[model samples]
Target: MAYRLLALDIDDTLLKSNHRLTKETKEAVEYVKNKGVYITLATGRSFISARKVAKSLKLSDPYLITHNGSFLASHVKEPVFERRIGAETVYQVVDILENYHCHFKLFHEKYVIANKTRQKAQLISRVNLQLTDPLFYPVHYVESPSHRLIDQPLSVLNIRAEFWNKRERRDALEELEESVTGIRITPGGKEELFINHESASKALALQNLASRLGIAPYEIVAVGADMRDRDMVSQAGLGVAMGDAPEEVKASADWITRSNDQSGVAYMVKEVFRKQLRIETPHQ
Candidate 1:
């Protein structure tokens, strides 16, 4: 089958373990783009953080699926589609999180507002000096995020929290799940959790974008390596899982490629996409 759109998850599915895009991977993405396959990044990262990767790919006017598909937009200021957490829910989440020993960050389209925690919860660097864009997801540290939210409510795209202790993280997740009404919490990393609106998911956003592009579920390829990516991976026509992905994630995939460290994305593009395209294309 010839796929029309290719949706890739940025963190583990696309980038390496060190968080760098390799030349081979870039070329592979270019290969698919040259073949006229629509490529999009469906990531849990904010638009700005994902934009850094998108810009490198030279994707002209890419419709990015960011914040675990909570926000879908081509430009930073304007969004094609979005599902932000309500101000009341955001306030409740913040108030509940403040009781835990975790560093939570509020995600917006342009900013990553974080809490000033003792454990140094700042995950991203100030800026990539190599890039000219000064505000590449500029992070702002607030003393009390709950206070700020109470004063000026923000319709946050998602909330990411990293815990000092795994047990605390588990407890916090349990509490939040129990307390929150309209939020979906999923494990993002080792000690991290991402909270988004109940209705927001990579699959939901991907389906929405696919409909807009006139692509059917059977004409799409989705790749990811996390629990958050389960639906998208399973529902897509060709669901690919990284070699290092969890068993459950792997079980849902139609194909499993090498690990991210081995440039799994590049491998998949060549072995799966390229090979399939060759079989479908007639000789000149």
Candidate 2:
């Protein structure tokens, strides 16, 4: 089947370990996009955080599946679809997290509100640079985010927390799961966890976007490198997993491309999409 849409995860799937988009990857994306295949980013990142990558890809007006599907929007202020964590649930989560030593941030479309401790601790400094890019995604650091939220009451898409210790991360996950309702906690690893609405997932968001575009499920290609991407990859007509992806994620994929460092996205696009397109085009 000819795939019409390509959904890509941002972190490990698209960007290399250094968090930079290679020239080859960009060109491959351009090649496929020029073939009338729609390309969109399906990332756990907020809209603002994902903007730099979108800008690099020259996606002038592309649909963004952000916050792990909690939000689907073309522009920052104009949202086609969105699901915000209820105010009460947000406060409850903040209160619970405050008891721990982990650093957390509340995700929003325009900006991120994070605990000041993250800045002080200099956690994930490289990633912080991306998250705090003033032109794209500005970060607001506060001493007590829960109190600040009570006063300001902003719409939160999701919450992401980073832990320095593996045990602490596990404990935090357990505590949050036992105490929270109407929230889903996705343990990214021993260092971090993502909290969003239970209904939110990249697969669901992709489905919603595809339906709106009149693209059938079998006409979609999804690529990712993390377990969180499992559902999205499996549901796509042509599911691709990064070579370095977890075994389970690879098992769910229809194909496995090279690792990110080897420019897997470029390989997949050129080898699969471009080559296939060429095969289908008759010599005239």
Candidate 3:
């Protein structure tokens, strides 16, 4: 079936090795855009980070699924949907991380609050490449009235933990699930834990966007490389996994393309558009 919408993940799927778009990829996207296909970006990064890529591609003011689906905004920067973790849940999670002596960073909109620890600040700095001044609010040195100090509608409650110890993380997540109503806990990277609402994810955001555009689930194509992206790949009409993706991720994909550094996305777009053009041509 011809895909009407193409949803691509950033990180290791769309961006190249150095996290930049290649000329070939840019040209391919432009070609597809002229073909009248709706191209959208689905990513774990926030809307701010995703916008750089969208602007580079010159996408048609399409919808964007950012923060793994916690936030959805249009190319014009208009918020179409958002799912925030409850304040209570955010407080409890902060407490839990503190009790376990695990470093973490809290994201409240564009403001990222991290303890004075260099480790936590470094993590935030890496993800938010442009964060020159990360407001260092020392968690340990805070004054009295700690309860009132908790932030509101935390976007991402990130915890730094041993990712290899799956059992420990799983137990923590299971416990968190019991306490929070609209929150979902998932693994982030190799040694980190990310918490967001159950309603937040690329799949949910795409579904919402599809509904708004009057497109069906099977009319879209999704591609990604992370475990968090499993649901999205499963739901898309044609789920593609990056060549460098883990075996588990590749297994879930309908097809495996080249690595991001090899211009995999550009190749996929070229093939899809070529086939589309062939279909429009008269039979021999």
Against the reference, the lDDT scores of all candidates come to 0.83, 0.84, 0.68
Cα-based RMSD of candidate 1: 3.7
**Pairs of residues at least 3 apart in sequence or in different chains that clash in candidate 2:** none
Q: Pick the candidate with the highest TM-score.
A: 2
Clashes of each: 0, 0, 0
lDDT of 3 by residue, 179-274 (tens): 656667777665568777767778989999888877788878888988878889888888888888878788888888889999998888766567
- Residue 148, candidate 2: how far off, in angstroms? 1.9
lDDT of 2 by residue, 162-197 (tens): 887888888888888998899888777548898888
Stretches of candidate 2 exceeding 4 Å from the true structure = 118-120, 278-284
| Model 1: residues with Cα > 4 Å off, grouped in runs | 120-136, 276-284
TM-score of each: 0.92, 0.93, 0.80
Worst 10 residues of 1 by lDDT: 123-132
